[model samples]
Target: MAKAYANPDVLVSTEWVAEHHQDPSVRIVESDEDVLLYQQGHVPGAVMIDWHTDLQDQVVRDYIDKERFARLCSSKGIANDTTVVFYGDKNNWWACYAFWVFKLYGHAECRIMNGGRKRWEADGREWSREPEPQYPATSYVAAEPDPSLRAFQAEVLKHQNKGKPLVDVRSPGEYTGELLHMPDYPQEGALRGGHIPGAISIPWSRSVNDDGTFKSARDLEKIYVREAGLKRRSPIVAYCRIGERSSHTWFVLHYLLGFPKVKNYDGSWTEWGNTVGVPIEKGPGGTASAEASS
Candidate 1:
């Protein structure tokens, strides 16, 4: 038998989703890097949440304000008490990101569909192209944004300075400063290319199987505990070029492994590599420079 996850309730199988997606008390949300994927076809009754426009603040680098978040949930027919299930393409990359955002706003009942869109498709599940019907507007009062779930640049700096565990979840190229960003994606997010000092290069994909489902808890423990030496109770932070990939790792460590404290640095490399005075280390086994440079 596979070892159980620390918080198994946070993950639901594709079969569980198929049976319960129509439950009036459950809301299925699809978020993807390719924003248009949902319009092509998605789980029936699943609503789309675009990470760029729906979750981000238009003017600032931060997420949307609490009022906007409340309006968004209400518009999506998600009441405070509704159970939210998130799944998406890219191995649920953006789905985990959307889940992180919801948690930032203190949504209590949130879960990720195991294996995401890839698994659902592989299983030959039903898909719908019809536009989702508008749900009745709900009254959703968001709790004050939780500071503990998010890490700012300064907090990340302090975390690293203290030699706490930091997981760099980007591709090795990005981690080693060989490529500024993922290949074929825009290479323009940062001026400098490298990782924060003392960060472990554990690509997010390592935690998931070829089918895009997460590895078993025993397998996960081998990777994160035996290999990476991450402790279940340690405070850790994860980051990627733009934070989406790192959010996936955050979900793994925090929910799957039951780490007591893990935060996603949303600003990530776009902010870290661009900031002039922040320290950056380049190349494999590189040393940190007090000032970042091209």
Candidate 2:
């Protein structure tokens, strides 16, 4: 028997998305690491939200401001009560990231399309290359950013010092001092390799099955609880290169496993590895030391 997720309502199937994507009260959003993938064809009626351009501030490393987030939602025809469904490529990697961002803005109703684009295509669903349809702009209001869902560098350091758990959701190469980024990736985001001191190495993709759907709650518990020793009640922090990969883990921990307090470190390795004076750990031995001078 399969154990149920802590919050199964947060995940909608590709079939469910297929049926409800066109409904006026539902907004289907496709967010991908490859910003151009949506143009190639996507779930019919799905709108594109480029992770780089639409969600991020151009001049700063932060997300868009509340007013800009409201305008973006309004332009996308999203009302405060509308159910926003996020889906995309790479097992919904960027989809989960976008979902996390929406939560930070206090969006009341948000869901992820399980299996995302991979399953959508594998299921033989139809895709459309037609121009994105624009609905009437809505008067969406965004709430102030939620501090609990996000973690900054200083907070993360303090959390580490307190012996709290931090999950490093990157490839093992990046987790060790072997690589600055994922294999075959740019290898340029940070000045150094290795992970934040005391973080546990758990690649983000382990939470998902081959079809891109998340694994069952029982299986998830085996990985996170039984093996990794994560408790449901404890606060945790997850991070990847720039936080996108860790968002996937954040969803699994917080929503699926019912963890009460979990934060995504958006600054991630980019900030930690580049900044001076922070402590880092190298190799599987997990020794902590001050970051080396560039």
Candidate 3:
């Protein structure tokens, strides 16, 4: 059973938030994720960090821009001594995205809210109608972004057409090559899905519950055991449009299941499924289709 706060490595619930919102040790990031929602309202002590703009790497078009990533935490008053609790809608992708960036920069004491704001609102929790003002500027010592947590376009390029299980966590339409309104769905709806030649299509939706919290560990075990074909020794690399969803999955596999080393293709289909020259396998599960370009 996955008790939200019990497993610090995985998740935390709204109840946990209510209980600990004021703890000096715990910092809450509202992760407005969307500009509109942020402007509207948020948790009492929550700090706003725009998921798409503030949290992402604007340059290098790759993993979290190293310098920008470090600055983000410091700006948010996140010090090396702080323990972070991240929450937002978008199926926890917003929270997980920041969580991944924090991990990428060598901080490990972060947990995503199990159900985000939905749970809080559903339970009639208090909602603040205004965002918090910025705090006084304080410099946080920045560290060089760690590379082990990042996987690159070039790395995926080397693996393209290699018959590895290129997992796609995007929606079915995106996978079936349909253009979607949401640009974030899959690298702006770029990949002609089906899937990578030997890839798996496990949309990230299967991983979470209707309430937005993750399924329990036992339940998660069943999903992966049956749907994912995960083995004790299987080497898995999870990907989504621009790497955020896959980072969520990467957290699941690495922290929850204790998988040896689940690499997240951070560029994901954004770089692979959208790029013109690197190969792609467009077909259903493990169909083995490849344009085979050098």
Candidate 4:
């Protein structure tokens, strides 16, 4: 397939990772929805970074601050210059989320392993249950969080008012207010169904192929630019049930297609749907109401 992405360096194939798994300057991190999967088996030399525990603050809904982020990097043997490659289960959903957080702290050398854990395992690669040796911790200083890449609920509301591009990367059922949560998943504290008003329903899975690797750049161009009518400079915001899934789309548009101004609304539907009197939209055709209760 033709490579059409503007910045293809942000992604690396499983083969590239296999060769560099032992490289000293490269750190392989696995972040997964099922945290215990790393203990069972993971790519050799890859350390585990739990999204819920390591990437996010325990008390607050926000991500970890620079201090905690520094601690995490040192513990993981990551330096400011380490090329961090992330891969995980669920077609790299949590992997992209972790990548987004790393970018938040301005880690400049982050990359995602294309196809994630599934593709690696499917290709008959070796996995190790033994623990990797930790390197001497470095004083990893993180840059201030880049607010430009992230969106708060207030910004989302404002974006809605402005009629800017808003991508709802959840499933069709969730986008239509038919499924209150992901199929068979818990309610996850959302008080209402439906999506933010004026959001375009573009499920994140559409960005990847059946093997979990992202589609060719031409295909992606067709989906976002041609089909969705997005421009290169369009100010776009992506969201999902809790923001994990939307991060995938954020990475694709911002990194792959080189969309200039795409931000992930991390609060997403869980925050939007619960806010009193906030507008919500239902159905594929985008009919909306003042409240999700309708």
Summed backbone clashes in each candidate are: 0, 0, 1, 0
Cα lDDT tens digits for candidate 4, 88-201: 999999999999999999998999999998999988899899875687798899999999999998888888887777888988988888888888687474778888877878
Error of 1 at 267 (Å): 0.5
Which pairs clash (backbone N, Cα, C closer than 3 Å) in model 2? none
Candidate 1 similarity to native, TM-score = 0.95
lDDT per residue as tens, model 1, 110-219: 99999999999999999999997579999999988899889999999988888777889888898999888787788546888999988878889999999989999999
Q: What is the lDDT of candidate 2?
A: 0.89
How high is the CA lDDT of each candidate model?
0.89, 0.89, 0.67, 0.88
| Candidate 1 lDDT for residue 175 | 90
Q: 146-184 in candidate 2: lDDT tens per residue?
A: 999999999999988877888898988889979887887
TM-score of predicted structure 4: 0.95
Over 1-294, each residue of candidate 3 has an lDDT whose tens digit, in order, gives 333322455577788888887787778887645677755767777888776678665674654565766677777777777789888877778788778777777775887877887777787788777657454344655567766666677765555445444556777655655543134433365544444545566677888888877777777666655556665345567787778788878777666666665678877665666667665554344422211121
Q: Say which prediction, candidate 3 or candidate 4, comes out ahead on lDDT.
A: 4
lDDT of 1: 0.89
RMSD of 3: 4.3
Candidate whose TM-score is highest:
2
TM-scores, each model vs. reference: 0.95, 0.95, 0.84, 0.95
